[model samples]
Target: MKCWWEHLMHLPDDLSEMGVVLSRVNNSYTAASGEPVNTVQTVSSISNREVNSTDSEHSSVIPIQSKVCEPEEVLIPALPEVACMERGYVTPQQVYNLLNAEEGQPALYDPYYILVLDCRSADRYKDSHVVTARASVTVIHPALGCLISCIELQKYCIILLYAEYGCSPVGSVKARADAPDLQRCFFQLSDLGMDPVILLGGFSAFHALYPFLCTPRMVLVEPERHMLTIYPSEILEGALYQGSATQASDYRIIKNLHITHVVNATANCPNAFPNTLCYLRLRLTDDGQQDLVEALPLASRFINAALKADPAGRVLVHCSMGRSRSSALTLAFLMQHRQWSLLHALRWLKERRACTAPNLNFLRQLITYEEQLFGSRLTSLDDIRR
Candidate 1:
């Protein structure tokens, strides 16, 4: 008899050959591992024979003896850890399962809490953010220096961004200035009974990841003439619009993009001239009955016009911050295009943009409004907007 193990080692990508001991037994023997291990094909005629590697003449006979049972099939992919490191995720199948599952499961085999933080700017979020996410603070502006803060704070869940990847990505880009710090942040936070999943693409990705959980930022405004403005030019003064600066967060971003309309959702502002700015604002409330019926559709129209009129011309729809109102309007645009139902629309949107929180009240009102308009007609954010 010849040694089967020696010949098995030469096969390509064979895990069984990589030392998964295949011990043969009586015909009635069941595998203790219960993993559906198949028996050797020629088990009936096989006789136990241990061949020593020191014996050089047995090489030729070994090949014939080992050709009995073919190698077990490779069912799933053996993903490389390094490949996962570059993509910032385990697998597309895993991400899809996560997105599709209605309820989230805890970390495998361990009771852990996931912490997600909104780290846009230190000045903006100074001493702010979800309390559960304090593992470390890594700022996403002016060279991304918060690596130490994250390590010290032990932040587990970190969502870093400032005006859409406009900031951060600094600190010798060759060494993964932002992501490396996130990895360290999670590792440190893991020490404190927490598990972190940093938003890979920023808060936008988180918003996309969980849209139904979003709350809308309210903008209470008084109707002026026929449109709405988040903050009047006089009120904005030095706070809202800024001069030409590629990196600054101001009206210049809209102007440089040659946007036609600047739809402001902030309430209580008097109107004024365009003044190199984009378009006018459309309020979302009148006598408090969710003014979005008038505002949302108009916003949809303006965005459509902006995109079609120039395609490159951008439309900046904003409230006090870019979190709520702007996000809602953008979502509306997306719903209109995709014809998705309100729930599905919200779900899909969050899976793509996660920095938003659709206020529960706002969501209810939008759903109600959509239902009332369609009246037994299947409606979604996408259906109404388009």
Candidate 2:
């Protein structure tokens, strides 16, 4: 949690004391000879004769609660209120910095959550935007739709909403006004484990405003007559970083495979390319992934092209580490193309790519997601192939 400064969004207002309680009791206490039992029991006691007035006329009793044991002490840091934003947003620079921060601060040392919502027209969302986006799509009203935002929150650490504000006509399905649905669409996202900072602002804010505010601990506020739309520029800034493993040894492998670009699966990576070679950041949140579930349709279009480019293009798909994310994506490709079943796809990836591993819990949920997709589409996995 130490490097949390890198991925947490700033609180719009300081509400630290609200909905929080902290208390401590020391080990020592003193009591008079004859004392009545009180509701609050005395934990410890110590006596000193210095203050005694050499007379029995008056006696004083100072009682204290239980003392904290030493050597083996309990340190319980408090958690924030249910509604307060705990983790921050992501950015491009943090990805690069994370790969090369000071020795004491390794990029992979800490784990952060990401939440992504698809506010785009329902159909367009079925395609793709940020690669790591989850698939928790529901309506603004809970009873009106099958999806729920709240449930998605239980699985991810951060959330991003991808909207198509002006892409469609005013009455069209994909207007920016669909923004508020992000909060309502999903099941209980406000539950215990959901992080607030990573909830991305309107799509435009992420695609446009973020790059400019890359410094950690800084905030950008859009002022209005009655309210303000504030963005946590720092978390996005610090979390951004360059693409995956840059060791010289890996360069040959990458070039041999003809990788043309790098797709960073974290919101923390820059959206644009750092150099002539194309690079993109897909600030994926677990919610978004829950929606899409599989990445093959997108990855095949992107990665296969790299493989077939004139000079040939190989691609590096990476998340915080080149593990779960890239691996899950690889599984998506197999599910879409190869005849392998979901279980087989995962097993093959793990066997061939040692670094390939999705969080076990995530994998379980993904299985359900895939089953739902298949259940709705093909009668079975076999039917999809034909």
Candidate 3:
């Protein structure tokens, strides 16, 4: 008798297409009569030739053999139910709502709830954590096992995990250390059938975005107290004051800087300055998906009009973060007025404001806008020569 390996080597490549089912029983493998086999097993083939008496047709059948081994005790790990397998990223605001929802709330009753797990060191968590987050040591299995048991009792639970600012944030581009403890905990809980999501930007980003909601912990060190006021940075003398939403709200900052016009670039975020200043609201989202191109022409016209309207005319362009959307608009206005390429405009802005990185998509749109205005791409021979 030929070995199983030898038989497998001679089997047809199109055996699957032949509508034959291969199965393994005990120590031997056999091919089913008509249907295809779907059993998991190693396959071997044997050729048997037979001639039909009535039709005088030659038919070939291949028999398969499987290797057998001694039976051994096998244990399978239990997986969580399908309902508890939800995992993804959740925004800071979503996490906040989950923690703040009142008892007997409409959607947040019994089956639907949220649990925030702070996976940082005990000391760091003691320093600060989200108001409702539970600081737990996640490096060990017992700690995670206890959390999993509690999660199993809940009908529908959303488990949010967070650490320091180094973990992936909503709008951050920086990289950080590999968080093995957090990863291990997430996997273990997920395997046991629990819905989990990483809080994007972690506690640091969350704290920065929603400082009012954070707990009052001991000040580790007397870090420089940077006031939250938005002081407008002068881009063009008497022409522009680029800053954040806080600055836009600061009438004193606006008045002291002699800002005659205001361009609000945030969507749904109201303009803080009064009607005394000329207002142009773009209503753009600060994320990468915002259509900065759609508002470019209008924003440029407003900024240019402000500058040309008076020698002392100054316009303040601002967004919620004063980073992505506001910076893109400011760049657009500079490119339009100064006839500078996008690269040159960005360099100039960065020199004035170190934190002016427009999101990737917005930067791409600025390149397209540059091409539209200058009749060439953002980078040209003139730029390279300079």
Candidate 4:
């Protein structure tokens, strides 16, 4: 006996060819042409109907059973293990600092090393892009060759991908359609074993935040408004001091605090005490996006060496503002020297310096460093919030 679905499949393409008028009644289909055509009820509806209600004339009808087709399993190729730092997100301020870093300077993390790709349209990219950004329609196949060539040349290349607003703008019907393609490009680059970071809030947000840095024609704003005053605070009893550039420059305060060493955590922040004090200048940026992982070990060594040099020696760590960068290094020092957990060290520092807190990315790197030292993570997202 033929199945009901098989019979329906054999129907004429033009239903009118057989002079048949197909109509549905309740859960069953009926064909009205000559006499009342008895059709097999659907598998679902068959159980619901009374079996005895079927006439002897329709006894030959066969009910078809529905079978579900299972989806085929697919194997995805694993990406090669590239020895690279975790590429997360960068901000406009960090991008600006990277572009403005002085030439021939020794930087812990070089922004020039990373390849910034603007994923906007060609016209939009032509109008303006981040100072060092390259325009790309797609970063998959065609761009892969160039990227691979750069890798072969041993050019430590990290890819930074950004779209218009990090996502399709609201009410942008066309952009919404193409949003998935942009995301696919990012993932494809990652799958190709390249370190890729997506800029947070994208080009629009960056342009709004740093318009002067974005285009050449934009005028520079006043510096005083952006300038932050320094106030050195004690991290350890007398061994560690965390402060800003201003605080580090104040010779009177340095003398009063009995400081012997200074750790400058800014890219081009000059050494205030040239011959008077021992100095270790780390070409670091205060921006949250700057890579603190690479600088952690070096900064820790400097702090430890300073403390080990003399029992009474005092080290002062400072950046443009002593809040983020200096605090991060101080935390790293405590974690490395005292073998304290990241959270415990942060809590200890916070007790002395109320404003001691690293940027989100720097804190994440500290967490990573903590895990590297210990066997597991000692801090979590909730701990950071506290």
Measured by C-alpha RMSD in angstroms, how accurate is candidate 4?
A: 31.0
lDDT of 3 at 65: 26
Highest-lDDT candidate: 4
lDDT of each: 0.36, 0.36, 0.57, 0.58
With candidate 4 superimposed using the best TM-score fit, by how many Å does residue 160's alpha carbon deviate from the native?
53
Which portions of model 1 miss their true places by more than 4 Å? 1-153, 159-249, 252-260, 270-273, 321-328, 348-361, 372-386
TM-score of 1: 0.36
- On residues 1-386, what C-alpha lDDT tens digit does candidate 3 reach at each position? 11111112233455523433334344244555543333221111122321111111122243332321111222121222222222377656455445433322212223335456777878888777875456645322544365435445254456677877544432233423445546655666667666567876678888875565566442112131112122555666446767778768877776666777778777766756443766766667756666654467556766776677535468889887677788888888777667777877877776566567688778878877777776667554345235
**Global lDDT of model 4:** 0.58
What is residue 27's positional error in candidate 2, in angstroms?
Answer: 69
Error of 2 at 225 (Å): 61
State each candidate's clash count. 36, 61, 2, 0
Error of 1 at 247 (Å): 13
Clashing pairs in 3: 21-37, 169-201
Candidate 1 per-residue lDDT over residues 208-251, each given as its tens digit:
53332223321112222112111111101111221111112345
User: Which 10 consecutive residues of model 1 have the lowest summed lDDT?
Assistant: 228-237
- When 1 and 4 are scored with lDDT, the better candidate is 4
**Candidate 2: where is the Cα deviation over 4 Å?**
1-257, 271-273, 285-296, 308-312, 372-386
Q: Residues 205-274, candidate 2: write the lDDT tens digits.
A: 4435333212222111212111212111111122211223332124443343333565556545443334
What TM-score fits each model? 0.36, 0.30, 0.40, 0.40
